[model samples]
Target: MGSITVSGVGKAYKFYSSRWARLAEWLSPFHKRRHTLKWVLQDINVSIGQGESVGVLGVNGAGKSTLLKMITGTTQPTTGSISINGRMAALLELGMGFHPDFTGRQNVFMAGQLLGYQAGEIAELMPEIEAFAEIGDYIDQPVRVYSSGMQVRLAFSVATMKKPDILIVDEALSVGDAYFQAKCFQRINNFRQNGTTLLLVSHSPGDVVKHCDRAILLKGGRVAMDSSSREVTNRYLDELFGKPDEAPADAEASIPTDSAAAHGLSQHDDVFHSRPGYHPSEHRWGHGGASIIDFLVSTPDASYPSRIESNTQTEFYFTVRFDSDFDQVVPGFLLKTLEGIFLYGTNSYLSSRGTAHHSAQAGSVQTYRFSMPMALNEGHYLVSFGISSGDPRQDLVPLDRRYDSVLIHVGRDVQFWGIADLRATYQQLNA
Candidate 1:
């Protein structure tokens, strides 16, 4: 049996003039009504079977949240019907059912009841919930007195403790420390093992890979793609970081014959794809003496590869064309996460055991190729490459620094986080 079913769902909101205009209409009594309806979602059809894990992927303001809210029955769709089987729990937003003035413990009971748990049932699970929250005495304090992380802990515990047949999580995992996040993942894994259906919405590709079997990509309030987690994530990233001015190949052709409407449609398409992802050259760097002319990520066939698989080897090709040559030039590169966490770096001078010097004539193209292990956890990463030379301890001359040389996508496989996946083995103990 299906856990959730949404058929031909559509949602729209009415836009009206300001209060002053409404008051003027009230006074005039005969003023014609001026109102516009904005459609946020249209013809969204999807179904989730029992024990299935599905992910919703989209850029900001793509109506992902709206869809989830509709499915959870928090918001009604303008058209279409939704049927959900069994009890449902949703952690749509942090502190969603929480009162700022109420103690965390009190809110736990309220949220639990809202999730269909009886007060006696919640009391029985309170210990596990408290242990999971790990907030100690603060649990008795007002929610407003708790930190963001603490609030997340409390909400996550309460939502998960009820063990609903359907669980809808919307980016609730982004907060919290690493340890608690890992705990949350463990809980989610347990849920999967127990045949609980999960509907997840997250920007983190890694999470999608780990938790979701299938994913749906929403673009412009419509279902764009429905496929495996990896495929959906790739398409979402492509659209997210795609060039703003470049419309999809079919966009122009798909527009209607009306010139004005076609132009408006083109503009709308551009606006949707313009949402930022990991774009090279978007990185800001310190002033440098030299500039990176070009950098690229390519495959063995010299074709530029957009998406990458985990535990795979790839070649990074970069070229630094100098405007002017200087003595004792050191060229190097660093790979960083989209959030600016440095993953790995290497420099010619550092690896060469001595000063790697190169004198470039003006407008000279110097090429460097590195075959690095792709041990990245699946997500978007930035490649920054530049050249510098002088004293290691003192000031150095930076020739060129490119913030985003390339975007690397590391996908998830049966492996762990690290710079390299050695394909480790293990054995289980039996008691």
Candidate 2:
């Protein structure tokens, strides 16, 4: 059974220059009210089953937050109705219900009370909430004196303590540190296991893929697509980058027709793959005269492999189509962490003088291949490639520069965090 039913929900706001505009309208009997109305949402209908986790995805100004606000009763829809089956707790924004002048401990009581918890209940749960927040004595200080992260932690802990029947989170998890964010995910997962219905609004595709079974994509205040998380995410990204590619209607079927499949050509019916040539788009310039092109990741055997398992061997390939062939073409590629830190880089010219004299042909593709060691600690990483002649400043042509060139996932097997997965042998010394 659906725990929440939203039907024909719509919201609109009228914009006026000032009170004078309304006054002028009222003064003139012949004049009609000249107000510009913007529809924030229109005709949105969705049914969320009990214990179902649904993610809402959209670009900025797409009314995702507005829809959530309407559902939570923070704002009312201009038309239609929303029927929520049970008690709901919403974290639409960080510290939404918290008073800045109130201390963290005080805010806990205030928020809990607002959620219908009695004072005695809040008092009994205070220790656990405080421990989860991990804000220390700062909890005693006024919220106005706390950092944004502190406020978020306090609010999150207090909200989740009672475990409301319906939980609505809108990018609030992004406010905390990595560790805290992981903890929050764990708590949300636990809530899911206990049959709590969850609605998450976030920009991260990974979050939706990992947490939600279903997704709703909103575009221009309308439901663009309501389907599996993977399908919705792929469609959202395609729309985001103006990439004209369609995700398969049935993603579970044998054909893989998502963004990963668009870059490369597919041959087999069961598995789709990228073609052999290096093709990189979404180009930009980097430091000095360097460009990147056709940068892609693929398995040694598989034609096109974008997604890979943790601790798997793969090949990173890209072609540097230089602006001008130089006397010494120092071709290289960089492996970067998601934060833009250069984890590792190597160049053909630096490695050896064997290819130094060979000037690359302009308008011709120069291919470079590296055996990516299975030592990458998962998460998302980018591959950047460039060509420099002589000194980096003297003469050069940067053919390819692309962010998020390849998406890598290091699964649960790797226990470490950072750029590389250094398979180090630990020896316990007996004293």
Candidate 3:
């Protein structure tokens, strides 16, 4: 009963440099073009049949969301058309179709009406929606106060309140907490099991691999690759890693081989500050007992880079000099988003599982190295390094701390929504 067909669809936006230009264009009798068209999508064609599951892959600004908006009839295509053979339901942008001032329950009725449900029909589904959303009293409160996670919970609950012939879900589901996302996906899987045609967008290739049988990847506003989920994901990953355009900001600048000697020297040069990933506004503090003087972050293919491709093995190294006896010291690091959201972090003490005790002697030098696969989604992240000493029971004394010290850009295929990239593959053992 469910099928979708998109024919030669393209979307373009007109840009005007100033209000005067727009006014002149509107006032002109000839209607001469004063604005240039910015094509977000071009000449797209796809046919998804009943009971089929597909994944849409794309980088940021690649018009993935726009394509979904068109298919869901939220916006008109500048050119071409989309057709759905049966009833369709979609979860697009987070909290879309929801009013910030409206209560979750109120929005449910309104959104359900827009989804083609009658008032009595929506009322019958209210209890099911509220139970699924599980936001307690907040369900009766204004949506504006709901956290991003809560909004997605309510949105997902409403979108999937009833089975439809076709269902489309996007990365907005990733906004929910891990536990709730699992619950949401379970419902999606249940819908798909009931012969619902599904189209999903995920930044994590593993998700596409696991959830979808066919996949399409968009590049520069065009369908660059379309094939089995495995094949398209492989191509997407390859294109991401080999990108010459993803170079660090320091690509245009270089340090001479002898420049280290020219400037200062072994007497102590600020090597960390010279690297391409170094952030100028890094906050530094802590006592003078120990100081972090140098650092290097590298992969097998590159070192001290401004950009690191996702899913590559990365190693972090930082040199700390103990000018005074720093007892029971433990080293640590943090990888956080620009907004200071903690993505991942670990200290040597935690790494050792509280079994190891460490102390630094005066005039001693220590370098800490941590290695892992950088599975972060495409974005800029800040890296911080710190060291401290104290018993595990309570407080600790900070020896040296660097906050938001290094800025790194990650280039990756969109799969899982945020930070950590999961590697998932699928094989049909039988059938």
Best by TM-score: 1
**CA lDDT, candidate 1, residue 182:** 86
* Model 2, C-alpha of 56: deviation from truth (Å): 1.6
Model 3 TM:
0.62
Which candidate, 2 or 3, would have the higher TM-score against the true structure? 2
Worst window of 10 by summed lDDT in candidate 2: 270-279
For TM-score, candidate 1 versus 2, the one ahead is: 1
**Cα lDDT tens digits for candidate 3, 241-289:** 3434354443322332222222222224445675546777899999778
- What tens-digit string does per-residue lDDT give for candidate 1 at 1-431? 33999999999996767767666655776776666679999999998999999999999989999999999888999999999987787888988989999999899999998887899999999999999999999999999999888999999999999566888999877888878988987888888788889999998877887789999999999999999997887677677656333544433332123232222222112131122233535654645545554443544432234466765566554555566656666777788876778878887766666655566666655666566667666566877767776654467677566666566666665546555556678999999
True lDDT of residue 43, candidate 1: 95
List TM-scores for all candidates, in order: 0.79, 0.76, 0.62
Q: Which stretch of 10 consecutive residues in model 3 shows the poorest summed lDDT?
A: 258-267
lDDT of 2 by residue, 2-90 (tens): 28899999999988789788778778888787777899999999999899999999999999999999998889999999999988888
Task: List pairs with backbone clashes in candidate 1.
Answer: 289-398, 289-399, 290-399, 290-400, 291-399, 291-400, 378-410
Q: Estimate candidate 2's alpha-carbon lDDT, on a 0 to 1 scale.
A: 0.72
What local distance difference test score does each model get?
0.74, 0.72, 0.81
